[model samples]
Structures are given as C-alpha cells and as structure tokens.
Target: MPTRPSLDSIALMRQWLLLLVLAVIAGQVLRLIGMPAADFLGSMLVAIGLGVRGARIRVPALAFKFGQGCIGLLVARSLSAETLASIAHDWPVMLLATAITVVMSLLVALFLVRYGDLPGSAAAWGLSPGAASAMVALAEDHGADSRVVATMQYVRVVCVVLIGAVVSHALGSDVTPPQIPTGTAPLGFTVPANGILTILVLTGSVLIGARFPAGALLVPLLAGSAMQLGGVFIIDLPQWLLCLAYGALGCYVGLRFDRATFDFVVRRLPSMLFSALALIALCALSALFIANLLGKDFLSVYLATSPGGLDSMAIIALDTQADVGLVLAMQTMRLFGVVLIGPYLARQIIRLSR
Candidate 1:
C-alpha cells in the first residue's frame, strides 16, 4: 500500500504542472510569432518579473535541476571512439578557441567591474561561457549575490539564443512554430539494451555528483566519451529523453527572470548588451578564421564559434538539420576545455590588466 499525497503537497504539484504547461504554451506562442528564441527570453522575463514584484511563484527547483542532469546522460550516448578521435585531433584548435574566449570573457568582465561599476564576482560569473545554472551556482559559492548572478547569466543566455535565431532567420531559414519530436529513430536503427544500461549508469554517476553544479554536465560528458572510446559501452538514448532535456532546460531558463533582476538588468542594459554583442562578435571572428584555415563552411564554424550553452546549441543544430553530432561533440569538447582552463586565463588577464 502507498501513502496518499497530502493536500498541500498535491496543490504544490498541481501548481508546478501548471507552470510547466504554461511555459510550453508560451514558448510555442512565441515561436509562432516569429520570435522562437522568445521561449527562453520569456522565461527570464517571467522569473525577473516575479522577483521584482515579490510574486510567490513556486518554481520546481528540484525538477529543473534533475532535468539539467539528464542532458549530459542523453548526450553521452552519442559519444564514440571515432568522435573522440576526431575531437582529439582537433583538441589543440578547440583549446586555443577556449583560451581565447575565456580571455575575452575575463577582459570584458574586468571592464564591466571597473568601468561599469559591477561586482567582480557577478561580472566573472555573468560572462563565463558555460550554462547559466553553472555560472549562478559558482557565483553563489564564491559569495556573490545569487539574484544578480542569476540575472546576468540568464540575460546573456537569452541574448545568445535570440541572436542565434535572428542569424538563422536572416540567412533565409523559416521562422515557424517549433514542433516537439516524435519518438522515432532514423531508418534501420534500433536501440540496444546495453546502450540503455550505459546511459543509466552514466546518469546515476552524474546525479550522485550533481552537488558540484556543472559537474553533472561536465562529468558525464567526459566519462561517456571515455567509455565510448574504450568500447566499454555503446550509447543510444531515446529521442523522448532528448526532447525532455531540451524542454526542461528551456523552461528552467524561462522561469529564472523575476522582476527585481529585470530592473537591475534594465539599469545596466546598454553595457550588458554591448558586452554580449562584443563577445559574440569576437567569438564569431575567431571561428571564421579557424574555419577558413580548416576549409569548413561558415555556418558550421559559426555554430562552433557561438558561446551558447552546449545543450541549446545542440538543439538548434538538430532543428536546423545541421550536423548535430559534430555540433555536440565540438561544443562538449570546448565546454570542458574552457571550464578546466578558464580560471587560469582569467588570472592571466587580471595580471595583464593590473
């Protein structure tokens, strides 16, 4: 026999479900309105509005965190030795890009801190080129105000998503309503049981260590790639899982923008906007140069250059029918590479600036 849910608990659950539904509906509506990136931006707006207005919107923080944990697990299945080998071959280039991006981020952050009158930790976490959640958590750990960090990180994410969508649209891509994936593998493909088991194990590992914030995203990516390279496990996560991961991430991002943060963000709107555009431009130029040297198409290089979150970029790649696997592999490689070396680059920049 199972215990029944208390009335309060049931009410809370219902409220959470309603928020998720509303988020999805809002996201779709925005996409239909030719503002597909509005899903993410909308969430940020909602979160900031709530914070500012002192609205008691009960967000399902645990659910959002769990959803993020699943992203790496789902992505892990796509890793294999061939992909690993390719990443290894391009490791130097990827590291170089990561180094350059981190340096650029730090320089921008320092400028924002000194010239823009922002807190150092807030600026540092705000500009770090990982997921918004990772930056916020790190900022909190480092004693920055959580609200400010959350605002800055999500604002940047929204900018990246919007800019990406606009760039896609400008290139003559259709800006139509987004559709959820139907759970179907490509023709002649069947998921294996062993692959399923591997994903579960990897996911378990991530959850057990998720207290480390970005560790959940980073660990599985590295471990999964290693396991695949060693031929220890083949991964083939379900399409539904990937869709859920994307939706959850988007929803969480949307809900992060409460009212107080919005006002704060609005106050520094010009500087923040300039910083984001500058970073995007710098990354794009770097990618273009690298792509020219490698003889790759500009779009592929642009995706590689963009400092968006890995999961978001992967989703965009899938939607556009771009090389999803290559995008994921390259983005994952660069994320970990940057996270590992970002602080050192920041230190160097700090030294040079001083």
Candidate 2:
C-alpha cells in the first residue's frame, strides 16, 4: 500500500481544489449577469475572501505573466493596418496626454506626502501608475516604507477596479456583449500556421520580457502587433483560453490581499479610498481634454487615462467595446514614461520634503 500523503501536500491539494471550485462558481454567476471583466472580478473576490479566511491561496507570478501575455496577444489581434495608421497619426497627442498623466500622478503623490503623512518617496512610488509589484519592490531599495507603499498601491487597485465597474455600469457601457471580430473563424479553431507563429511570438516575447520592466505584458504586445501588421500571422485565440487568462490574472491580484494585510489597513481605509477617488477624478478631467483633442468617445478616453493597471484597462476596453488600440497605446506610453522618470521624480519629492 502507498504511504499516506504528507500533510503539506494534502493541505496544498485542498487549497487548489477550494480555489478552483470557488473561481468556477463565481465566474459563471458573474458571466451570466453580463458583468464587465466578470472572470477577473469574480475570481478576485473569491481569492480575497479566501485570503481573509486564512486559506493559503496564491497565483504564481508566471501565471500572472501568462495572463498578461495572452491579453497582449488578444489586444494585438485587434490592431490591424488601419488602426495602426490611426495610432501613428495621433502619436503626438497620445504622447502629450501621457506626459500630463505622469505630472498628475506626481502631484497626487506630493499631496499624499504632505497631507497623508507618508514618506515622500513612498508616496511617490505608491501613487505612480507604474506596476504595483515593481513599485513596491523598488520602494524599499529607495528608502521608502514598503508596507505603506504596498498598502497604497493595492488600495488604489481595488478602488479603481470596483469604481470603474460601477462607473461603466452607471454609464450604460457594460451592457454591450463581447464583440469578437466579424471575420474571425469560429471560436476554438485556429489555422495551424497562425497558431505556430502565435505560439513562437508569445513564448519568445515572454522570455525577452523577463529582462525588462512590464515586459511580460508590453513585449508580447509589441511582438503580437508586429506579427499581425507584418502579415506574418493572424490568430484568433479561443474564448476558453482568454477566459483562463482572465481568471489567472484575476487570481494573481486577488490572492495578494491576505487577512493580516487587510486588517492592518482597515483603520486607514477611508483615507486610501479618498485618495484613490481624488486621483481618478483628476485623471477623468484630463481625459476630457484628451478626448476632445483626439475626437474619441469620453468613456474610452477616460478608461485610457485612468491610473489603473494596463491589463485592467485593457479588460475594460474589451468589455465596453471601446477602442482597444487607443487605450493600449495611451496606457503603454504612460507606463514607459512613468517607469523612465518616476525614480528621478521620487528623489525630487524626497528632497523637497527635506
């Protein structure tokens, strides 16, 4: 007879089974109700609840990156030649709008420093629209309080997603069904050549992306775009795969909110919520100008300008049938801009505080 499984193995198995069941139930219920980012929102809530209950649930980093890569490919498929031309012509406006976002983020960070009593550097990194994990990882190295920075970064994420969904529903934008491209082959089917190229591009880009900040998402995106634009390949990913990606990404984010962390931030929750709302408002106002300048819809521009994660914004764009290309372009530009200059600006903020 086989030896009984170790306790750790048994515990791990139980955790996986629990998460899988909850994610599926939550995902199906949300999907039926026509919710935006249903898979993500549902799985995230489940994970968060599990964490609060003291279950050891975690979505690996590779899982998050895989989800990002899938999204990058999906967004790339939407970028045809005509859309690329539109993006090229509007590059200047996009650049300006991105610059404005960075400035706005810095201003908000400064406010947090002065009014919230957070360390200058921590406030800056926390409020920056760059990657939360990246910011938190770098914050300590730069003398920022990692705990505060993490708290601030994740609080903003939770607020952005919840408020964004409400805003979309309020505006009547979330009612639209997922708009798959008309000319695409049936779901679950892909041409072999297209599939091979798609796999190669995604795998290669992800490998290279490991070396660059936000590269897991951005690099795959660039690769997918190049492949599609160059006439090298056009693959319509299966809906199931997309759903899996969404779930993976959602779980990755949701599982991070453990009970201890949640408890620690409870007293300060109000300020965090207020700060998140304030930043979103400022970004929305800026979006109005960008929308006017670019002649796009206010909703699309607002989502693009919203200081949330790129993956989150992409999901919103896809959900609302917004111009995914423009949202991706604007968000990507701002991401790179912030990553490049955010450190220097953080230093300046620290100096000023001193």
Worst 10-residue lDDT window for candidate 1 reads 180-189
Q: Native-vs-model 2 lDDT?
A: 0.79
Candidate 1 per-residue lDDT, tens place, 240-329, comes to: 555455565665676555555666778988888787888888888887887776566666566666878876665555445444456676
Best-matching candidate per TM-score: 2
Q: Can you give the lDDT of residue 217 in candidate 2?
A: 89
State the lDDT at 201 in candidate 2.
Answer: 80
TM-score, model 2 to reference: 0.90
lDDT of 2 by residue, 144-227 (tens): 888888888888887777777767767787555444442323333347656666777877887788677778888899888876
Those runs of model 2 whose alpha carbons end farther than 4 Å from true positions after fitting are: 1-10, 174-190
